[model samples]
Target chain A: MNRQSLKLSMEIARVHLVSKPKQTIVAMLGVTFGIGMFIALVSLMTGLNNFTEELTMTASPDIHIYQEETSSRKSILEEINPDGLNLVYHQKPKNETTKIRNAREIARLINLDARVLGTSPLVSSQVFYNYGPVQLNGTILGVDILDEDKLFDLRSKMKAGRLEDLLSNHNGLIMGKGLAKKLNVALGDRVVVTTPLGTTITLKILGIFQIGIGVVDNVRSYANISTVQTILQKDQSYITDINVKLKDRNLAPLVASELQSKFIYKSEDWQAANATYLTGSMIRNIITYAVSFTLLIVAGFGIYNILNMTIYNKMKDIAILKAMGFAGVDVKNIFMIQSLVIGFLGGIAGLVIGYGLSFLISKAPFNGGDIISLDHFPVNFDPMYYVVGIVFGVSTTAVAGYMPSRKASKVDPIEILRGQ
Target chain B: MEPILTTKGVNKFFYEPEKFQVLKSIDLTVNKGEFLSLVGKSGCGKSTLMYVLSTMDTDYEGELQIAGQRLTGKSQNELAAFRNAHIGFVFQFHYLLPEFSVLQNVMIPALKLNRYSRKEIEERAMTKLKMLGIDEHARKASSKLSGGQQQRVAIARALINDPDIIMGDEPTGNLDSYNTQLVFDIFSELTHTYKQTIIAVTHDDEFANKSDHRVEMSDGRIVKS
Candidate 1:
């Protein structure tokens, strides 16, 4: 209870641990390996998760607003008298425009809201790219190059020319690298495009980009809004889609619902669009924690085993100490201090080793091939993980040491002395 | 001389291996500064009685008092503190912690007592070791010493706290005749020259005959004093 007694207990503990150097180091290594693996696995897994999340999240807007075609199959007879049983055998599909009315006005109004970071209008249509003798299907997206760059950071994804080139040349288009490869076209090369309306035009390639998604990279291309409007033969106000980026992406679902009700259009948030990927992320997180915790607990058991053996070996010492007027608490403290010292030292070593391993992993080469463009493995060096790892390690050892220390304290000196 | 330790109607039982009585209504008293010995055959409860008197065994029925303080019904922690400050013990085996130096082993009880400064405690420990003629080995590990020297170190440890009474459970049981004689002389000097009270349990008749008073026990009861 007093400082002097505690000092004595610590002294005894230090001596005991030092006496059996081999056993002490073995016990410490258990914790060291457990915590080290925990740090490495958690940091790498989280880093990968963040990398994948950014790849998908930044490529698409937080909220997408577009017009959806809907046609009711109800006949005129049913509309006049709903109770009457009226059935139409073969219902004809109704023709409706997929373009949103007043799309520019909606974008401007949505941008005025404090939550909205920016909004970019897009006019996209399916087309066919014609090389000399080869033809491939693709989708052309018409966007204001500067606004698109602000929303999606398009400039960084550019592999060849700049967005400024597309803006300057009216007939210029930026093509995905995969599409460019397929058509055998490079920057400043001319390619023939046939629109869905059978309107053919020759457009010069201004830039080449790669978004890392195979399907998108193989078929998607970018062009100026006016050029796409002229190719589609639509007026200046024609817009098919509005992409909304928010300051806080977490508010996307709520804002999307509000926009849907206000504009009478289909509004989809990124989470809803990528529900499967979110579930996969959650599963990966669960696995990471489960494995890390198992490693730590195994390490804890190692400490427990070593402490128990130490207590068993030192039974005579405990009895003698008790006989010398050392209290039960003092004996317990001596053993407890041994375990804590191991935990503290092992946890520190684990942190250092974990950092070293993470650094190595971050520099390791990664070939994502045509699917994703990455040169090195991802590893996040978050300080919070280190704090959590050490705290968990120490507390685990404490719990593990508790039972053996209690047994040591409860030892009856009389029994031991009598047996001797 | 005034009585320093007294017991009235002390009784103890062992529950394991079926119920059996170990100490039966034991009543004894020892004067201050007296060297007393409890002698009996093996399993006659001399050792059990010693444990009870030393406050290490509290499972007994009767009043036990030492240095005019009733020690019955005291908590284990309180009894441990009392033992640290007031009573010392010398076991049959020289049970020194193998990893600690001779001086640290002697200073353990005094450190637990915490009444004196660390420097003062160290000085007292050194004095006790010198008095026992083991000062040259103070810095050596206790386990590295001979049996006689280790027993002497145990004696020094007992004396470091200046306890009122020193109890021994066959302190010379494992020693040869020469070492046994050395320990006997140490106990005699501790009592006569230092005016320290001592109670030892021994099977050696010669050792018992020379003590100030000898108490004999048979089958858990004191037969004669």
Candidate 2:
């Protein structure tokens, strides 16, 4: 706590470190390279994680709200398993219907949330597509074309025609590229679409989109909300689902849970629906941190070995210091301060170098076609990664330096002086 | 005058390899400002006794009182603090920190004692250096100085805190005859003029004979006083 003692100790530490140039630099190199690799690897992994998550989120809505489920036949069957006989039973409930009448009101409430980016009410129905000599069963989605484009990135995925055309023509529809190919239809072509309730309507194909998802591209089509509702005999307010997107995709699960509690709706976030993928990412993060810390500790060992050798080499000096009335803690502080200086400098340099490496990798041009639609390699530039790297680097250095300092403090001054 | 240092029935042993008695039932006392020399042949335990008296070796079975404070059974930190404030040491090796400037080396004990500001310690260190004729080399690294000059710097470092007692273990053993005489003159001046008490362990006969009192030891026991 005394300023003069602290200054004296720091001066001694600085002299020792400066006098032994090779050993000091070598010890510093351990931390430098350790933290460098940590920052670099963590940055790349974080970038890859973001790349993958965005790829997944592009096709999926951030939040999905479905018609609420009350205790029905499924719950009854689960409750009465009938003496553990493992019997398979089926029950149909009269109140279990797909249409939610207040879907627009729920969408309005959700859109009021600052976190919500966009929301759309959708009506889904099983439909049949028929040409001159072919018939295929598929699913049709009723949506407002403009809101659907904002929610699903529909504008960028269009391969033929325009999504805006669907707004002007109520009888027009957009089908996936795979569906268009199967029905032998092109833009401006007419197809007879039959609802499962036996209502047949002829609709012109206004747009073709390919999302690269096998199931959706093969069987899903989109029609104007009013047109699909008329064909399915539903009121204008009825909708089967509400698809919601958030300003921050990471807040989806939180917002979903909030909405689920506040309203009579079943809500799901993209992460919950893809639990396996999230778990895989979580495991990868654990592995990255484990490896980073292990490397830092190894670097710490390098410091430990150097400091231990310094203590041995300077045994006479240590003894003399002790004889001059430097306390054991004072001796220890000299070495501890030395290692901390190394850690601080090394961590800073490592972060700078790592950032340079990340920038270089991100800027590298890629001529090969990307299957995930990324034009170049994806790298995240999150500041949190650097903070983590520095914290781990400095602490590891302090811990590693402590062992040698303790040994130095316990050095017998008389024994060493007499030996000389 | 009251005794500045006292040791009652002191005994010491070394446990390395086997049990071996080093110092046996030693009783010694020195008055304030007295110059006393402990002289003996090799393996006579004179250095061991000095270590016990200096409060550095606590393994001995004895009670040591310095400046009227009980030094026996005290913690290492307490002893170190006590040594810093009251005792100075000059060793044969002139163990100054090689990396530091001579002035810095002299100021270390004062700095550790925390009784003065750094600026005040620096001034005190300069005064000590000037007294030893090493003030001109104060800015130079201790290792860069000549052997005789380094020893002078060591002595200056010892005197920086103005200790009550200056303990020396073969303080002039490594010096040439001329430097040894110079060191003996300094010690004589320190005791005669500055009223500094001295206790030294030495194999040098001339050095022992010049002191005010001599205690001779043989086979771990004091034979003559």
Candidate 3:
């Protein structure tokens, strides 16, 4: 009833658990191994997801404004010139006026919304870089470079020279170190950049950067947006996408809705674009639950075995109980309590071992690289795991204890003495 | 005097497909604090009647009562609870939990009783063990005790719960003469000191003759004493 009796009973159960030391340790080892497997597998999958999400974090918007554009084709070349590559593509350009007007007007529209952290304009174009003999086709980004550090942290990671060279110098550019290396370009080297308008402009590579993003590091070149727009001789209307930032993580959806309504009605929020997170979470949950169910049932088998043996051994004791005016239910409870203790102790062991192993693995060298990702495993053992585990352990033990305890209760002290 | 334990025309039979009558019509009673012995040969239904009075088995056609309650038509749990509150039992084999010490074995019944405090139960168990002169062995495992001493411990354990009636089934059947005599001597002391009703099943006429009253049984029928 109290902790004292519970302690005593647990001590008694402990003795019984270790009575067959080899069996007890072996059984516990099986559970530990199973739980450790759970930890390892879950951590690996979560690590993979986190790594992918980390990659997304590097490239995706602080907040993305989605237009009604289906992003099926990936390669810049394939997306721009679909019919030229044996595919009959007949997609027309979007209404540039509406898109540009909406993106440009959001800066003046909202009345200083607290959740509106920042808004940035983005324009991406496929441009070719010409060096001595290398012609590297790469993404030419026209970033504001104004408070650019807050949005992407890219300028801070400049491998050589100064990031200001791209802004102060009118005809300056910056490419990732790998991209520069591939194009045989270096700091202060002049290169020709062809924009989507088919206008070629000469730019000096004042700096090179490396941020561990293979996709970005190998194929990205950036310049001042106004310089690109002026050099291309476009109009005062050239905002491809407007990236918005929210003050708090929880306010992202609400802010996204407000921004969508206030900025551009057709723009998508972060959650709708990151559907894989929701779906991946559901899949991970299902997997974790299925594994735990299968394993604890196996663990329950051990509990069942222990209780069954205890009940069989204590048949005469149960008969004595009946003779002593203990009802069958009381006798059942004694054994039931014994199993519960076993399950509880074992469950705690499993949880600690499971979560502990996951933590160790999380710190382990499991991730495939050192770029934008982890080397350790990951395990998010939420409250749900504990609730399920304890319930499963206790109920399994109780059910396991049920049969033998009931059998013990049915014993007749008289019949037992008389050998009936 | 109103008997502390009684049975009226008790008839018991074990029936599967074949009906086996273990006890015939029998009437018996023992006054409070009296030591009574039921002496019979093997298969004479002495054990059956003992079980009936101890409330171990309730399926029987008889007016069997212990302490104050009628012992028929009650559920098995009710019978078990009844016995737990009122009856203490000893067997000839000295059926103690070998895993426990002598004191622990004696305290088992009291631990099952919610009414008894742990200190009170231990004190009661010690008192019984001391009276039977096995106090010094209380801490020793029951399995390690000498046979006579072990039987004495068993008697002490049966008396530990302070039941209104103590029933022994062939209490000395498995013991040597020394242990057997030791066991009967404890029963005598139990009756005299605790004013307890003692009913023992025995094959030895001499052992039964020492009781305040003796009933003899033959072929499941109680005939003479």
Writing each residue's lDDT as its tens digit, candidate 3 over A36-101 gives 455555555665666666566656654676454543334566778777765446655544432456
lDDT (Cα, tens digit) per residue for candidate 1, span B42-116:
999999999999999999999999999999999998998899899988989888888989999998898888888
Q: What clash pairs does model 3 have?
A: A66-A268, A324-B84, A325-B80, A325-B81, A325-B84, A361-A377, A362-A377, A366-A375
Per-residue error (Å), model 3, residue A194: 2.7
lDDT of 1: 0.92
Q: Model 3 chain B, TM?
A: 0.93
TM-score (C-alpha) between model 2 and the true structure: 0.83
Worst 10 residues of 2 chain A by lDDT: A366-375
Candidate 1 CAPRI classification by DockQ:
high
Q: Grade the docking of candidate 2.
A: medium
lDDT tens digits, residue span B1-225, model 2: 779999899999899889999999998889998999999999999998998988888999878999999999999988888898999999998998988899988988988888888899999999988888889999998889988899999999889889999999999999999999999999999999999999989999999999998999999999999
User: What's candidate 3's DockQ score?
Assistant: 0.50
DockQ of each: 0.82, 0.65, 0.50
**TM-scores, each model vs. reference:** 0.96, 0.83, 0.81
| Top candidate by DockQ | 1
